[model samples]
Target: MQVTFETPDQPDVHALIAELDAYLYSLYPPENVYALDIASLLAPNVEFAVARDAGGSAIGCAAVVVTPEYGEIKRMYVRPTARGQGLARKLISALEEKARAQGCSVFMLETGPTMQEALALYERMGYKHRGAFGDYPEDPLSVFMQKVVA
Candidate 1:
């Protein structure tokens, strides 16, 4: 498997984002979901990466939205068939590397409490619980986390 930076407009990436959106929508209410749309992923400050299998099928994706203070992770997802193989962890590591190259010293992300697996992964990766950042406000349904990039 390989992870590479890409725009969200690619057909496979677009389809993967659609699947991610559907999955998130199913897990959280509209107000609690904060996923970035394709246009947002194309923003100048955001870098998106996709993990592809040997055949070049996108199996997972993640993004880092760079700001003055930190890089915010967004739209992280791994296809169900691709789970349990550390693709999510690989995606996060790739995003962190991208963010570090951009001079970001910190990384943050917002996820829902219902996503226990995600929470566990973040914590294991050294992200600590934090209050909301960026445009996010305090919400019971949102769990915020951050890690200092070494």
Candidate 2:
């Protein structure tokens, strides 16, 4: 597995982001979803990564939002058909490593309340439940989790 980081403006990066957004939209109605789009995740503070096969075709991607204190995982998605092969975990480890290089000591993320598989992945990856942070309001539909990356 190869994990590569790049500015979201890259063509391959944009392709992954488009696929991610389309997948997310298929999971929920646009009005009911809180997912970020390609442009939003391309903001200055956000660093993105792509996990590729030996042939270098992207299989997964993650966005790590850097801040002075901690980092937030955004737009993390592994193709549904690619689940159970550790692609998601690879994307996560790559992002965490990049975040650490950026001086971040903590990692946090939010996922839909009904995403049991994702929630399980977070738990298995060492993230613990936490109260809402940042612009996230305490809502029954959202689950917040965090890890100490330092």
Which of the numbered candidates is closest to the native, going by highest lDDT? 1
Clashes of 1: 0
List residue ranges in candidate 2 displaced over 4 A: none
Error of 1 at 111 (Å): 0.1
Clashing pairs in 1: none
Q: Give per-residue CA lDDT, model 2, range 36-134, as digits (tens).
A: 667877788888888777787777788889988789998887766677888888888888888898788899998877789889998999999999988
User: Per model, how many backbone clashes are there?
Assistant: 0, 0
Please give each candidate's TM-score: 0.97, 0.86
lDDT (Cα) of model 2: 0.82
Worst 10 residues of 1 by lDDT: 1-10
The whole-model lDDT of each prediction reads 0.94, 0.82
